[model samples]
Target: FMPASLLATGSERIVSGLFLGTALSISSVKIVAMVVREMNFMRRDLGQIIVSSAIIEDTIGWVIIAITIGIATHGRIELASLAFTLAGVAAFMAFSFTLGRRIVFDAIRWTNDTFRSEYAVVTVILAIMGGMALVTDLIGVHTVLGAFVAGILVGESPILSRHIEGQLRGVITALFMPVFFGVAGLSADLTVLVDPELALLTVALVAIASLGKFGGAFIGAEVAGMSRSEGIAVGCGMNARGSTEVIVASIGLSIGVISHTLFTMIVTMAVITTLAMPPTLRWALGRLPMGEAEKKRLEREEVDQRGFITNLERLLVVVDEGVVGRFAAYLAGVIGAGKPTTVLRTSGESEADPVEAAHLDEIEKGAEQGREAAKEADEEPAHEAPLTRRTHDAPLSAEAVAKEARKGYGMLLIGLGRAVTAKGGFSRRLNEVAGAFEGPLCLVLKPAGVGRQMPRLGPGSGRILVPVNGTANARRGAELALAVASVTGAPVKVLYVARPGRDEPRDTVSHRRREAVLKDIVALADRYGVEIETAIRSRAAAADAIARQAGRNVALIVMGVARRPGEELIFGETTSGVLQRCPCPVMLISDARLRRDDEGREALRSGTGTG
Candidate 1:
């Protein structure tokens, strides 16, 4: 028998060990929480895995804690009590699996309809989770099991689950989780490994734990037919114990299963594993061709969703040395600089001619002159005085100039040729710039030598012309045009064409339909707080009617390019026809460019406007 003094000393040591174990457990959890919070697991695959592992570890730790508590209270471990506890846990899980699905689905649907707010739904979900946790804790299973089970149930309700996940993700993953880990690190005492044997044992245990997880995952991957490199990646990834291991260590310490020294060692192991994963993953990924399949899948997905892709906020501007073209290009550049600007060469007159050859001589000459002008402008500090000092009037017919600007240009810019020359062949380019191009046209003219300076329009410079037909593209075009109008404080003219067929006459129904469209335009105009004009014309060709109306005074004409199934016109024939006949600069707006709300707004706002 032991002496009373010796027994008392042994009891004191055991009590001290229990206290140290509990402290270590708490410390481990804190460390894990810190790492996970800092790492932002929600955005990464590793984070997800770490979170999952942590959940499992937490559950196991809680079970051990409960058992330790029972042992301490009873003064001995009872086999029957353990058996009963195990049976109760299994029974509770079975019930949850069966009834939890229905409850979760119904609850989510009800919450969605009643609350109408995502936050409300999240609140309901948390309530259910908390309730489930309470039930599990009362049943002596573990609150963590209940939390996990609740997560699984909620996960089944994809929509609600996604909403709650999104709402909670930042708070839980970014803030609280990291703080917990940092707190754990602060609580850890690294001096416990002063004994050489204890230090070696701790290291061995960490190695064994890491190898067990890594080996299991790698072997599983290999058995599932992964390549050697892929299996290795899986192993390396799984070896990262991280937050989960720390949580497990904490739980063990709380339950009196692990010593303070052992817990510190485990925490160290977790940190090393977490730090090593990134480089190991990079190396493993470099050695594997696993990304090929993923790349192909993403490419296919993009193709499948091509119709949904919106146009970028970019404007394609055509430029040349001609006065009108240069002014238009400069204006476009200024407005679209915040966007994207594409310059195309349109000097070559013939459609059949090779573009490179036709523009080669002109391009080279322009490049040389541009370089010289840039150098002179750079040397002259007061270059802003006036370009007219050295500017020689390059004589060209307005028609020729407009035609050159039309090639590949989304909008045409030209100075209004003298009205006296309007009927004359000399003002052909001005006519085209004003009416012929199927896009927005800017006609700028300065009296002979006074160069046209871009005037700033107040509030209303984004005047746009949107011709709607109720089609998706037409609606998009209208919205885009409106956005532009809003930005520039420009008025919108929504022209809905009602063409009378050669056989059919314009009737009451057509008139009513036209009236409805006008009303819509007016309503939208009012909503956006801009000027709106609606026109319905009886004509043979819808494109011609629309163009004629649009050409009247608008800064830009926005029209949809119709695309049809099989034997489809590559370029909208109607748009091309309008481009050929319209008097104003035409914007051959395609569905491709006006997909996004922002892009649509930018495109519509991108032109010279007279506010």
Candidate 2:
């Protein structure tokens, strides 16, 4: 069929056959990934294999396609040309995954943090993709390879937020994808298939493609220890060619490697296979039952997916270069791991603000302390988001924050030198700080002498304490505590303070509720691979119990509480009490947005000011 099809063109049948085989064998990564994601099977084990295999097929297929493209560009297939293209591709991929990887991440992070313009990061991403595509074309390979590689690199960037990802995804899915496939459809004259001979060829082309891909995937699955039914499903899943076929045929047509009739046949085959794929793959996927292990893993992944801190897109740090500022830097670095963070450095408190008068000496030393803490944070994993320090010459104010807020930070973290301000100690600064952002908040308060001791902190191999209630905020705090503990290999102590009740021990009064809370937090710690301990304080106030635990040589105290809207950042009496007397530094984390009603959210968005 290959020789007969190419007789008019007088091209080498063997080379044309190689191109046809490569094109037919490749599956569409975009098409398959979209279907899998739509079905919500992305985290399933079988789904993982199918998508990963398609990715592998796309990669190998592109390398082969690049070689052929190189031949077509030079008007002939030759050994020297093939080897040169292969060498160029090899070098390109090696450099791309290495230095190119770093460059791409840095470019995206820098653009995201440095620019205040809307969609600036999205524009930068598109530029990176186009730039890489041009590089591949200049190196005598297909630009498709560069574009595909670029997508992979961009997808892997830690700083890539859900909002940005979804935005890019929308453009591709709604506009570019439809346009590409629509253009392919318009270019393909199915009228060529009206001839009996060409119609027969299209049918044969689909059969050959379907069988070869199915057989290859089926055998691979079986060899990798899947059951017979699983292998059959894998074979069915791999049969789709979709857009990959159209793109390959288009490329071949443009380069004169295939005549118009052959291009039409390929496009017809693509349309048929793609149309038949969804129902077939869906049926096969439905037939495969989930194993116990897969179920548990998926459930755990789902929990992590919904977790508050885990989903944070970006962090805003407002601090001075003071002792407490340094402490906030360290905590932010720990929690902000992988999260893009912007630092707002207020040089010092204004002399007129009562905070400066209350803690004049301490405020003066904060800037130096913040620098050292930031330096220590830099010592953590380099793959995490790059911290951008926004230098401020004036005292921190809501208006300065309102400008950065336009850049879309998802959380606000405030750490300053003085615990008290003229407005009312801690709550005033928090009230002023949280006003500019419509997201969650974290407040890091330094204990009296913790500044001098902070340089000695944050290799955190000591015990960490977290007080847990069954509330969402408490769970979030426990999760954050577990994460910090996991990084430092510290043991976590879960405390539940129970007051006395009628005819029962104080701690025993709420034994059932305390047990449930402990159970949940312990599971959370297990997920993070951190050790956890549980305790109950009989007949005690929550603040007193937490403070006593913190006094027990605890490395850090993490309290999760909801923020209440008031004239200022007054969380509650218990939280305030704990902060006032706790000997160690305490971290107060809140999920203000989670509890907001529609009206409240509108108020927040309009900057009517809720913490």
In order of appearance, the predictions have TM-scores of 0.43, 0.80
**lDDT, candidate 1, 1-611, per-residue tens:** 21232121212344334422332232133334445445433223343444454455555545454444434333345677667666767776688778877777667655654564537777777888899888867765446557767877886553343335788676668886788788777657888668776577667756765677667767877787877876776566556655656665565455444555656877877777677765665566456442564554444334323221122222333333443444344444333323322344343112122323222233233333333433543421111100100111333343543443332234333333231122212234333333333443333332232223333322444345677765656655565455345434566778776565543334767666667766755655543346777765555577677656655654556665543322222335555555455454444334322223455556657853211
Candidate 2's TM-score reads 0.80
What stretches of model 1 exceed 4 Å from their correct place?
1-78, 116-118, 161-163, 290-295, 302-611
Report the lDDT tens digits of candidate 2 across residue range 1-611: 56375422745566577778789889988778877787778899888888999999898899889877777677667888778888889999999999999899899887875787768888988898899999889889778888889999999886787888999988889999899888777777878778887787778888988888888989998889998877877787777788788889888877667877888888888888888878878888888788897887776677678777667777788877666666676667766666667788776533223333222233223333434443554422323455566766677788888778776777888887666433224755556767666677787776554534543333455577888767888888888887666555567788876664333533753667778878877767655656788887766777777877887878778888887765466677678777677667777788854325678778768888553
lDDT of 2: 0.74
The positional error of residue 266 in candidate 1, measured at the CA in angstroms, is 1.6
Q: Count the backbone clashes (under 3 Å) in each candidate.
A: 31, 5
